[model samples]
Target: LEKAGIEIDRKVLADIASADPTAFKAIADKARAALA
Candidate 1:
């Protein structure tokens, strides 16, 4: 997100992501697409 000029709490995001890896990948892909 930083590369995309988006600011978010990495630690908080990491915590939330660790809860569900599958969801994390999906969300990550979406974020990448949006950033792209």
Candidate 2:
């Protein structure tokens, strides 16, 4: 998040972390894109 200059809510992150594999992968990809 710091690297991307982005901040996500803790609850949102927790939800993402607990999401299904596909959902988690999508969110992770978005984060990577932000960093890129």
Candidate 3:
């Protein structure tokens, strides 16, 4: 996950942590696939 362009920086991590898990996972999944 970190290997991709996704940034696990403080802000992004906080947003993801506070966000709905399912929704966040879905978005992350799509983004990872797109990157692939």
Candidate 4:
């Protein structure tokens, strides 16, 4: 997805985490610390 022209916000990813943490971790692990 990164290779494409796509982007995701930290909070949006965190919201996904609220539902399925594992998926969130996989998607936004790069921004985990900031999101916290």
Q: Which candidate leads the pack in TM-score?
A: 2
Ranking by lDDT: 2, 1, 3, 4
lDDT, candidate 4, 1-36, per-residue tens: 343322766677678879888877666655554455
Kindly report which residue pairs in candidate 2 clash with one another.
none
Q: How many steric overlaps does candidate 2 have?
A: 0
Superposed by TM-score, candidate 3 places the C-alpha of residue 27 at a distance from the truth, in angstroms, of 0.1
Residue 20's lDDT within candidate 2 is 68
Better of 1 and 2 by TM-score: 2
- State the TM-score for model 1: 0.50
Runs of candidate 3 exceeding 4 Å displacement: 1-17
CA RMSD (A), model 3: 3.7
In order, candidate lDDTs are 0.71, 0.73, 0.70, 0.63
**TM-scores of all models?**
0.50, 0.51, 0.49, 0.42
Best-fitting candidate, measured by lDDT? 2
* Comparing 1 and 4 on lDDT, the stronger one: 1
Residue 25 lDDT, candidate 2, scale 0-100: 74
Worst 10 residues of 4 by lDDT: 1-10
Deviation from native of the Cα of residue 16 in model 3, angstroms: 5.8
Candidate 2 vs. true structure, TM-score: 0.51
Q: Candidates 2 and 4: which is better by TM-score?
A: 2
Cα lDDT over the full model 1:
0.71
Off by over 4 Å in 4: 1-6, 29-36
